[model samples]
Target: MARSYSSYIVAQSKRTPCLQNVCQFISDDCRKHDCKIVSLEFFAQDEKPRRTDLDQLNLEALLNTDVCGCQGRLIIVEDLSTAVIETLGSCLDIDPLFFASQIHGPTFDIVSSKPSDAILPSRALSQNFLSVQYQRTVDFGACSSAPRKMLRNSNVPRKIVLLPPIKNRSIGLEQQSCSILLSTTKSKPWLGLILVDKPNSDKYTTSEKQLVLPSTPFQGGYEDFSERPCFFEPDSGSPGRVSLLEDLVYYWEKERPPAFQPDQPTLLSLTYYPLKIAAAEWVSYVAVISHSIKQFEYSTEATFEEHGLRKIDSDLRSLEVWGRRCLQTSSKLQSAISFLKYQINGAPELEEYSLMIRDFEYIADLVTTYGRRLEIMVPVVTSVLQITDTRRSLKEAANVTRLTYLALLFVPLSFVASLFSMNGGVSAHDLTIYFAVALPLCAMVFFVTRLPTFDFVPLGPAFGKFGNWMRKAL
Candidate 1:
């Protein structure tokens, strides 16, 4: 369900009607040129997941959605659409056909050896979107088809670009909104959005367009795609909310030390949104992994030896996934950092960009290194567990062997006593005979058991000499 966030921030009018009513209310003064912000949170697994989980990517469906302002009024479409897609080779290991099928569903029919997994007019869009394979040697082409029935689940598609036409009789005609982004965390490395409407020459075009209207969160049911499970989630609409306006509102009200310029908001929304998203990603990951490390180490300790091995197994796997995430994330952040290069505007913003890039770049590396080291401990911990099992087994076997030897010592005495008792009646003389018989057997058994040397090497030289002498005597 979409709710208006216009109240959260300072806006001219707070009339947040359903998104369906956009056409009837488009002409409203507050609706026109009013900044609309929509934030969609993304969630993805570390590996290629089953179709049921992701269904169709969120962005792809959004781009393909029939967005109309009125009942059937001509919605403006962007003249040009630009998208930057990033992916890791490890994530997209399937062939282009299979990948496309997974993303576009069974209806997704883009059969090619090269990775063009996107549903776009040009093959280059798919090719560019297949940047994951680009990281490694070119390989992931097509794989066997996995058929899925016509599924219209509640799953939200990847990137949703709503480019409705701006109708103004005063201006030339109607101008369209363009620049579409269709990607997922697995298919794309970095997770952020850039939505800006520039003044396109012609009629109905204006520079006051903000991408997402309705003040609503334009996200579907991504119950799974959540931030890394952290110690605690920052308050919503808080500075930690990862939105430019939220922070600006807090800054304007709370921290009003220096004269804050108006452009800072634009700089943040346009350029630094990605950085904020990326930074949040890093923070969430770091918090989760650090907690896991402690939990893992604690579980594997001697005190918790019952399921120690299993605990290590889980924690180590987590570490490995985290490392892969870091490796993939670093590249995506680099692209973002590079993109931030173009976003530099004034002196103050430039300095902010430099500091952010420097600090985040270090954090990106720090995450990678920390995760790799943690992952390496998997094998070591595994070996320790094996040794612990082997040692326990050996000790048990030794105890069993000692018990067997002790039992052997009493077997002969038990047998002799049973034989004597088998006689129905025994006189004193018979008892004396039984005792005598049993006594010699017990003495012989004891003597053998106590022998210092069971085997004595005969005089080998005497045997050889005797054989020679015997031959002559015979």
Candidate 2:
């Protein structure tokens, strides 16, 4: 049976006509094959954290429920479908364009349609509910080292499956889009909704073999080379592909900060922790990319000759790709900072997050620095390649010069010897004449070739006068 997303439309006559149109569009756009919900977690300062099964609970009522004192509730939706998006949009009264951006991945011109009174971050739409959408860089270890045809199979499970526009490309860096929407009121703190675009990881199994293997057969590893030069193994500490929902759940369960007290009146402190975590994760990505760039640069410098020009050229292109991705990530972080600044300045309810503003600024600055470093390193790498080419050219020219000298010395002697060996009257009568002619002729050739080695100080003025005379005559 074919699954039809468009058939499951929920009617909401209470919304504006514009919203209705947006909802209809979302319903139509929902893919028949959609991502399932990963997990549902609710966090409270005093009570133990708990997970709710999707089949047993009512998402609509749960999202709309008023919790004046609870810390926060986080809903993790993976590989978005029309039903989940439609339901969340209706429940939170979120802008339709946000879901639109989710359906159609964020673009360069992702700007809010609203005026400055409600300007949101990149691809975000400001309203009574505040949301920010940003791209998170994924570290695919050696799978992204060099361009190859590995991991192309769709049937194989992957830890992170990017949206249609972002999948299966050698863009130096791979990214997944994540949007965080916070619904708040004057009395209530906020209800957090995080929409992710990765596949659910229920069936994912990580092993020693899996660590060495890429997701698809043609994804990114040499099947033959054990120590593949192209493969870049991510650091064990690096957070390569993390689920924001799962990470939050883990933090709330095991690593919940002692600072979060039950006496706190608002959930503002708990809600934006995910954003902070997101920013911190980017900091890790910048480090990993920078480390990879440095490692490649070192290899090129160490053995430029052994690798040859083609290898160095490929490395240069890879460096440029890394630099570009870093710039993009930095730009996204800057937008997040701007959005937070606006929230802190304008929204009285968000004044508490002023400190988080500094943290984001610091992280953005760090990423920008690494990006600039990669940019600077590109020219240095080019220079090394140029030096290698120059060396090779000089060596080849020297070999040609040696061959020319050998030909000049042997040609005159061979000609004289052949003439003496002839039987006819035209042949040389004696070998002495042959020797006499060949020796002087060889010396003359040598002198002519070595003329540039002599410094003609005595004739310098004469040559200068002659060159001036020719110029005047012309």
Candidate 3:
């Protein structure tokens, strides 16, 4: 038997010309973009996934077939092409603007309902668009071919520095962007499209690679490359690690499924993972910063002991960079969480997904706490740095005071010697006369400089009383 579109879509095709027209549009758009569907799966209430290769699937016959009872569908694509966006909009009866927002704008999470003037009413009245970032270990193989110069020693051991977010710098860490589109339709089960844009090594041009600290995120590789795991294999009996997005679509496909899909609301509950993961990253980042601050103190003390109070302007600069990075990342995370909370609460379709509501609320609270923690660290870091600067200044001042003491003792002796060397002075060979004049002059100058009134006294009480008498004589 030949494979076909999901039963619900086929059934709806017979009743509504709008869905058929949308399917036709998807086909036309797909050809225009030269796009290929990575994978497509259809699910019914109590049946196995009717998975098929969408690239070879015919879109025309899909509208003529008659089938029923599709509870959900999943489409996985490597790129967010125009065709994918339009198809999602048509299927869920949503505005394409919601799905396209992340493309041109910044990454964020938003939930939107069908506009009042939408042509078709959807059973799933709301749609969710999520854009989240996740950290991944650098792929050295992919990065090696990039236009950027690789470190001389490929395996050179270097300490991972998070202050500058080495992960984002194409160093030891990489951040991948995951854009998810989730919705359900009157004719289809829960539908989800995931577009994971891996960091392209070629995205960074030669000029960008030369920067000591690039202003923008570093592109991992600069060469032509193909993204991997474009399609997530459905979990079989073997245990495997599935990401939250993958877990959402293939939940029922798991051998020991954690929970059955009660309805589309249940699917909404899974949306919590993105925000939760983001918050968790924030907590981890703050923890790293706190530890780094402690390390900064210890290292500074050791540096002072070994190098004798050398200036650490570089360390201060690094702290400033870390602070700015923290604020920028934290603000973004907060905005994303706040927006998600507001949209989810106001969305009528999500009323049944109570777990999702609570999850986001908890995330909001935790983010608030972590943000405060980050803020508190600022003063503590500043204080530590301030103490270092003060110590350096004091050390410099102490050296100056010792030099002043030497100058006090030497200046008068030097003056007497100069007089003896002149033609008008007694013979230079007259050692007795030279000692007689130089010793007294040097002693007088030293005593006057050490007098308490002049505030040069650094001796005991014996010197103190003598110095006070000298001050009166002066």
| Best candidate according to lDDT | 2
lDDT of the candidates, in the order given? 0.35, 0.51, 0.44
Number of the candidate with higher lDDT, 2 or 3: 2
lDDT of 2 by residue, 101-218 (tens): 4443222223322222133344342433333444333333333433331121112112232211113332222334555555553324345556655522222223321223233211
lDDT for each residue of candidate 3 in 1-474, tens digit (9 for 90 to 100): 633333334455455433443333334443322333433344445455555445423422332233466555555543344444544444455434333323321212133221211232232224455555533333332232344332211011111222322323333333434555665444444565555442223222233452223322223222111123325764243211223334333443432122335235333343444444444444444444554454334343523342333324444565565556555555455545554555565666554334434544554455455445555655655665577667767888999999978876777778877877785656557668889989998888775766665434466677677677765664
TM-score to native of every candidate shown: 0.42, 0.63, 0.55
Q: List ranges where model 1 is wrong by over 4 Å.
A: 1-154, 157-237, 240-269, 298-306, 341-349, 418-474
**Greater-lDDT candidate between 1 and 3:** 3
Q: Which candidate would rank higher by lDDT, 1 or 2?
A: 2
Candidate 1 structure quality by residue, lDDT tens digits, 1-474: 543322121121222211211121222323222232333222232111111111113434432343322111111111112110111112222122222221221122233211222223343323222221101000111212211111111111122211111121010111111122222334222222332232221121113432211112111101121234455865333342323333323333332222222212232333333244345445544543454455444334332355755655655565565566557556555654554454443456367567766766776677676667677767776666677677667778999988865775576668777887898888998878877887687666655444333233374565545545543442
| Clashing residue pair totals per candidate (backbone < 3 A) | 17, 8, 8
Residue 325, candidate 1: how far off, in angstroms? 3.4
In order of TM-score, best first, we have: 2, 3, 1
